[model samples]
Target: MNKTPLNHWHREHGAKMIDFGGWEMPVSYEGILAEHHGVRQACGLFDICHMGEIEIKGAGAWEMIQSLTSNDVRRLADGQAQYSLLMNSDGYAIDDILVYRRSADHVLLCVNAANTEKDLAHLLAHARPDAQIIDLSADTALLALQGPASVDVLRRLGVELNSVPRFHTLDIAVAGVPVLFSRTGYTGEAGCELFFPAAHAVKVWELLLAAGADAHCRPIGLAARDTLRLEMGYVLYGHELSESITPLEAGLEWVIRWDAGDFLGKSHLQAQKQAGLGRQVVGLKLLEKGIPREGMNVVAADQPVGRVLSGTLSPMLQQGIATALIDRAVLSGASEFFVDIRGKMKKAQIIKPPFIQRG
Candidate 1:
């Protein structure tokens, strides 16, 4: 198993460790619920160095990127970032990714930790001979500072938070270390991701925690992170998405830009759109007190209609909420359904996503 640079630091801080995508990572520190509330109310810091960062540069980089990703690369200006997908020929997603437009000839792609190598191989296979691609994951460290108090905490670090727009990045220096700061986050909160050299990982993390101490900032772990993202209806790679599932079926049409011109899955996606969808992803709120789990049957009138993709007890809503990919016909005809939780049928209602929208 792999370990990040801060592995020892996490152990010293009494973080409960677990294997996540072949990397030993912290699942919780104080506890999952406490950490969840911390991020929502005050602030929380996360060690996200296990994620992958690949750099694509040189002439023809733009063309190479356009051919591989689903989003409109041409719309991204320098210092801007976009949420996109690395798609398969069948229009299914290989991995959902974030693209940062560093310059006209350079772009950075951040992928999930487990799909790093697969994404790299896929990009290289489709890239032109002259397009330069570099994997910077091993040499870099990433930290996510999130919450409602994130901007104020950054301000204390001497950053002008007002200057950095959402989805925009800043090339700045923090505590003598050069860093790439982006106003982005996985948690549905105002936050920033700090990328810097791996050697300074511990120093940078300690600096931020100390700087935000008075603001009630603390270290968070993956357990709360998962719950936090699920509450916002954010899609996880293996659960909400997979090689068999297309972004359109995953309720991620916002990231698909057909007018951006041809891409890897353009034809299949265009056809799917024109022909309408057979299945759709929707959010479900348990009307009763049962925590839904993945692979559980979703039934309507004593018949199974679909399966739950991802489910959890939302920390914010304090209710059992889930994202389920079900037959579109069932979604249209049935206003309510039952989740088969361990042989018992529990009442549930279909609703639009973002089960815990803040504003």
Candidate 2:
């Protein structure tokens, strides 16, 4: 398994390690529950070095990126970012990505760790003669400082974040280390994602933890990260999305730009939209005392309607919550359903997600 720059620190701190997307990463340190609550109540630091970063530059960069991603890149100005998807010809998701526009001639893509190589290859295969694509994953290390007190913690390190807007990037120095800092996160909290040279990972990690000591910022792990994102109804690449699933079916139509002329899967997505959808993704909250798991069958009126894609006992709500892709016909009439768990049916109610709402 591949190891991040902070692997030795995690081992020394007695973090329970696990293999995630071919990288050996911490699942927890104090515990998942503690770390999960830490981020929600105060702040938490995360080593996200394993995620991939690709840079596209040249005169043709804008045209190439506009044709590849579903979101309208023309809407992004320098130092801004937008969430987007790479789709195949059949309207299926190739991968969901973050497009960071540095300029009309330059853009950066932050891709899922597991799909880095595949995403890179996809970009290379479609490369235009004037565009140059480079894989910067190996040289870049990402760190996330998240929660309500995250800004205060950064202030302690002499980094003022008041000037940077959310979803925007700022080139700044944190404790003397130059970084590309963005006011963005997966935990649905006020925070920032810091990208810097891989060599400074250990130094930056320790610095943030020390500076955040008074605010109770602990080093979070992959397990807590999963729960945090799941609580917000954010789609995981393999679970809520895959090569077989299209963005339309995943309840991600908001990410698509109809006015953006001619993308890779535009025709197929248009056809699917015009024909109407057969299935739709929705949230489920268990009324009983059982946690839902992926692939569990969802039934209504003794008929199977869908299958759970992602589920967990929400740490904040203390209830079982999940996201499922169900038959669209059932959504109009059925507000409740049953999840078959170990041959027993558990009652669940359908609701719009971001299960735990925040201000």
Candidate 3:
């Protein structure tokens, strides 16, 4: 398994290590519950260095990247980022990704760890013959500080919080280390992702932890990361999306831009939008006593209606919430359904997603 430069520090800090994709990463530090709440109320630090960062440069870079994804790349300005999806030729999603427009000639794509290599090969195959693509994952380190207090913490570090607009980035020196700071995060909170050289990552992590605010900053890991995203009703790559699933079915139509023009998946997506959808992804709130797990059958009136793509006993909502795909016909009747949890069917209710929206 690949280990990040801060592997030793994670061990020293009592992080529960786990194998994620090909990288060994922390599952939690002070524990999942503690860290989850920390990120919600105060702040928590996360090591996201294992995620892939590939740079596409050269005069034809934008032309090359535009062919592979579902969204329009031409709209992105310098230092601006947009969420997009990698698609199969059939128009199904390979993964949802974030693309950073560094300049007219350079774009950076951040992909999920598991899909990094596949994403590289996929993009390289169609890249302009002369355009340059570089994988800087091995040499880079990424950390995220998230919570309501994030902006305040960054202000203490001498950054004007209001200046870094959402989806914008600043290549600035922080704590004596040159780092690329992006105003982005998976958590539905105010946050920023700091990308810096691998060697100095440990010091950066230490600085955040040492800077005390309301309820001191601490290490958060994969466990809380999963819960956090789920609460926001955000789609996970493998769970809520795959090459078999289109972004339209994943409730991600916001990311698609029709006016961007002449991109892959545009034709099929346009048809889907016009003709209406057969299935829609919706949220389920478990009213029954059982916890909903992934792939569990969702039954409506004792008959299998759909499948649960992602589910959890939400810490914030204090209820089991899940994202599921179901026939559009059942949506109105979805007020009550059964989740086949561990062989027994338990009651559930359909509701708007984001079981935990920002207050």
Worst 10 residues of 2 by lDDT: 156-165
Number of backbone clashes in candidate 1: 0
Q: Please give, for residues 1-359, the per-residue lDDT of candidate 2 as tens digits.
A: 99999999999999999999899999999999999999999999999999999999999998999999999999999999999998777888899999999887999999999999999998998899989999999999999999999989988866676668888998888778899998889999989999999999999999999999999999999999999999999999988888867799998999999998999989999999999999988899998999999999999998899999999999998889999989999888876699988889999999898998975
Q: Report residue 305 deviation for candidate 1 (angstroms).
A: 0.9
What lDDT does the true structure give each of the candidates?
Answer: 0.91, 0.92, 0.85
Q: What is the TM-score of each candidate against the true structure?
A: 0.98, 0.98, 0.95
Candidate 3 segments whose C-alpha is farther than 4 A from its true place = 213-215, 333-335
lDDT (C-alpha) at residue 76 in model 2: 95
Error of 3 at 12 (Å): 1.4
Better of 2 and 3 by TM-score: 2
- lDDT string for model 1 (207-293, tens) is 999989988999999999999998888999998889877888898889989888888988998899899999888898998998999
Rank ordering of all candidates by lDDT, starting from the highest:
2, 1, 3
Once superposed on the true structure, which residue ranges of model 1 sit more than 4 Å away at CA? none
TM-score of model number 1: 0.98
Q: Distance (Å) between predicted and true CA of 134, model 1?
A: 0.4
